[model samples]
Target chain A: MTDLQITVNGDPRRVPGPASLLDLLAHLGLDARSVVVELNREIVRRPRLGDISLAEGDTVELVHFVGGG
Target chain B: MLVDGPFASLRVTRDQPSFTMTRLGPLIFASMSTTLEPTELVDTPLTIGGRHFRSRLMAGTGKYRTNQEMVQAIEASGAEIVTVAVRRVDLDRTKEEGVLHHLSPERHFLLANTAGCYTADEAIRYARLAREAGFNEFVKLEVIGDRETLLPDTAGLLSAARALVKDGFSVLAYTNDDLVTALRLQEAGCAAVMPLASPIGSGLGLLNPYGIRAIKRRLEVPVIVDAGVGTASDACLTMEQGVDGILMNTALAEARDPVTMAWAMRHAVDAGRAAYLAGRMPRREIAVPSSPDRGMLA
Candidate 1:
């Protein structure tokens, strides 16, 4: 599989091609249940993560609640 | 974040120590008893944006020594509504970093926040992401204008509140101690307006009692004082201003004993709220004797 360039949380990273959002999360060792994903400004629901494929130069943002005041 | 909104409530366990503590809480703070006074009925189940919360004090899950400590402190604080910030998950350290790993959303109603955003658009984005995380619609909207003080940009805050409210969010705006801005937030359809007691993380305590009181007096929605509370008295004083509730972090997270301080805060908030409802005695210029003049001994 060819590697494609993508942005995850604003940092450029290369991942194997033909990857869905769920595959991308797995590549990063992230549990899909724990974090929420936003691809190109649209939130990809957990179940739809596997359905949406990562494109070249896709902007992905993975977020979760952290400790803050 | 809790899967269910109002359904997630604190769980009661039969564990020995916690059980004893829970039972003793009433005896320790009997004056600030959960059972309301006859005149002051219906203080519990603080309703906001159609959600109900038993606690008026809300604790943050930040700056804690450890996750275990944070959990203990939050538990001790007796806060049903807890605030969490939305941020990009650190990709490098993918070890159970979510606050959810420690705090149970089932026990505490999660109130997501946009703590670090500086612009209205940025705050709105964060709030949307938080909502998409599949919790409730509540967001503690903050658009900080000053990095030094972490004071909110009233303009940005108002814009974000309006946008989020329009998007069907229960916007809980965190602003400064300004009645005009607070009123604007209320008008913007915020479920609750949170005015800071002082600068964020400053521990300067309640800087303007009258200002907070003014907002509480004018706003029809709940006015919750957030930030800058250093001690139990600070929490008490802020609550005594007639605000609906208070949300604090450093006061508990930074205390020598965060758990004890959290416990103190729980009592303080309850006491302050009760006092506000009970009302205070009028201040007199001259000394007034409790004994009657006719009963005074010659």
Candidate 2:
């Protein structure tokens, strides 16, 4: 298993093994219903988010959006 | 008998430069003789998620001091598509006068944005909440990963865009001005791509026309010039570069006169698009005029 370290919300997070984007979201405890993800500054569609695997040393950002006044 | 009324002595000036002055009298209007007509403007009608719009000028329903102002501004801007970010009908925030009371769904399409989420999953969750709150199928997918810059996390953005598209949501992805990143989002099936001119509230104008143009040229989806607009001229410049549309908030919202600025942007967009389609004459090393050569006798 490849060791993965990615920046989530500007903090470096180290997780064991290469994980799919779904796993990362699960680890973050985010409901698939309330978030959007960007991988290396590119938008990834939700359907493929479950399938796309994270590589070692990947720069990932997770964005959560809620309605504001 | 002289009647005292608003139009008591409206006179026609030969060339009143200002809009209000020019409208003082009934004058013969010319179609695109000097300034371009909105009807004859360039950039083909854009179809996103089955909604076809002739004008690419998009308006947002925010930052207006009054709802009446928003309505007037929307009409003046000639924007067919107006975006409204959905919020919980904050009844508590306004026990006497509600915040959501300012907007009406009958006027325009409500574009629900996940404004505060920190990840793709979080955005999706908000999207569902928005839909459940009766916002319909359209979502303005904004996956902002940074609070300081408010930049869309491309990884999270792409992830959310794909998810939303698959789940039957018409996603209008708000992205940064990166061609490669935009292409990836387009490939992920976003209904439209909205790229920022600069940071969200900077109003710095179009920071990279070439990059936006490249994205407009390469992507099959509509390219909307979103954010960082300071004036009508800025919007026009973007339209001239072949953008499908312009989405602005702070520029008009913070202008000296929001209504007038909205109309100015509308006309500027129509004029610039017409100029682009009419094709600008190449900039020459020397002046070239359509007149007989002065030194022909030589």
Candidate 3:
């Protein structure tokens, strides 16, 4: 199986095809409960992470709350 | 019997005293049981985005020296809602020790803000990301127009507010003290309109009180004065202007003692709100004498 290239947090990386968002998160060693995932400029809700599969060239932005006023 | 009047109620009793007393207004009746006190006045709770907050003082969680200091200041401020910025999750760090660790959701409502976003698209994206992060739907929509002024991009803010409201997020749009823009945000279905007292982090206090008052008078929703608070007096003045709430950060965080300043802000908000509700006396150009002039020796 060929590796698919995807961008996460502006960094491009190669991951196996037919990977769910949950799989991608796990691959990055991220806890699913802590981060918010945006797939191609759209937020993929937490409950749908496992069901939604990532495609090649998918740009994902994972965001979380930080110290801010 | 409860006899209703325009501003107060007259209660008549058939007891031995047989007198009438008016409550909740300036009307004083001759009755032994009638005692007027400021504590008797009921304060209306500040409501925004369908949530009732006891503290009309919302605080920011930035610029603190440490997370412990942030927690201390937040506790001291007595703010029920705290604003936070949304950024890319640091994957290298453990989630347990993140900013949320210091804040208890049960005690405080985490208000996620699009602080660094410069456009509508960026703000909208941050709003969605915040929702997905389980911080609920409360979003402080800030679209900065430039780096120097740090003023909100009114056009982008309105567009972002409309989009977020349509997307089912409770938007609290940060805008300038411009009345038209504030009204436009309200019309865009924002839960609240947060007009800046001045530029962000400027510590200038409310530079345009008339503009803020005009916004408050015209809008039905909550008008929160966000940003540019220099001290507790600024917060007090803002609240006294009849704004629903005041959101501040540098005022507390940059103070010599952040915790103490937070406490001061908390009381200032309460004092201002009480003063506003109690109704201030009309301003006069000429001085009035308090002592009686009748039968006074020349």
Candidate 4:
């Protein structure tokens, strides 16, 4: 299988092929329930995470709520 | 005097010790006396976004030395609502020991804000992300235009507010002291309009009380002074002007003793609300003596 290339939080990364968004989150050690995933500048709802698949050269932005004033 | 009737007899008498009225049978007699007493004003809870809050003071979690300090100050201030900024979660930081730990969800109603966003698109994106993180649709929309002034970009603010409201988010827009802009925000379905007392973190206090008063006069929604409060008196003055609540950060965080300052702010807000409800005396150019002058004897 060909290695998949993607950008996560502005950093380029290579991962195994045929991976789901949930797999990517688990690989990154992020709790699926705690973070929001933005795939290619579009928000992927939590329920749809399993339905979405990672492709070659996809841009992903992971965001969460932090302490703010 | 004593009066006799078919049903009963009534008697009225005044003595040095006391005044008394006596009634017989069905007729009841009551004694009357007069004494001057000060009138008290009633206290009313402030409502925002379908929620009622006893304290009209909202504190910010930024600028504190530590999360513990922030908690102490917020608790001391008696603010039920605390504003928080949303950003990309720092994976390096401990997930359980962040700001959320200090601010218990049961005790504080977290108000997420778009602080660093400079445009409507960015603000909207942050708002959505915040909602995705399980926070309710409550957001403090701040579209900052200039770095020097730290003033809000009204255009971006209006645009973001409209988008958020349409998306079912309860938007609280931080705007300038412009009455027209405040009204426009209200028309855009904002839950509340937060006008800056001055620039953000400047601590200038309410530089233009009349401008704030004007905004409060026209808007049906709650008006909260969002920024630029320097001290406890600043919060009091803003409340005295009839604003619903105040959202402040630097004023308490940067104080010599944030805890003490927080306590003072709580009192200040309450005092101001009381004073405003009690109705202040009218201003006069000529001096009037509080004591009687005509009865003076030489």
Give the range of the ten consecutive residues with the poorest summed lDDT in model 2 chain B: B90-99
Q: Rank the candidates by DockQ, best first.
A: 1, 3, 4, 2
Give the docking tier of candidate 4. Answer: medium
DockQ of 1: 0.80
TM-score of 1: 0.88
lDDT per residue for candidate 2 within A1-69, as digits (tens), equals 766887665667787667888888777665554445667756566788888988876777654322121
Query: Mind giving the per-residue lDDT tens digits that candidate 1 earns over B10-69?
Result: 222221333334332221222255574312122445779987666889999999999999
Clash pairs, candidate 3, are none
lDDT of 4 by residue, A1-67 (tens): 7789998888788988788898888877777876789999898998889889999999998876556
| B-chain TM-scores per prediction | 0.86, 0.81, 0.86, 0.85
The residue-by-residue lDDT of candidate 3 on A1-69, one tens digit each, is: 668899988888898877999999998887788788889988888899999988999999877778897
Estimate, for each residue in B1-298, the C-alpha lDDT of model 3 and write its tens digit: 4435432322333332312222222212233455632223334467788877767889999989888999999999988899988888665664435577788877899999999999999888778777877858889999999999989889889888988999999999999999999999999999999999998889999899999999999999999999998998998899889898999999888898999999999888877876776568999999999988797887
Better model by lDDT: candidate 1 vs candidate 3: 1
Off by over 4 Å in 1: B1-44, B295-298
Relative to the unseen true structure, what is the C-alpha lDDT of residue B223 in candidate 3, on a scale of 0 to 100? 96
Candidate 3, CAPRI quality class derived from DockQ: medium
Per-residue lDDT of B179 in model 3: 94
Please identify model 2 stretches exceeding 4 Å from their true place: A1-69, B1-29, B32-43, B94-103, B294-298
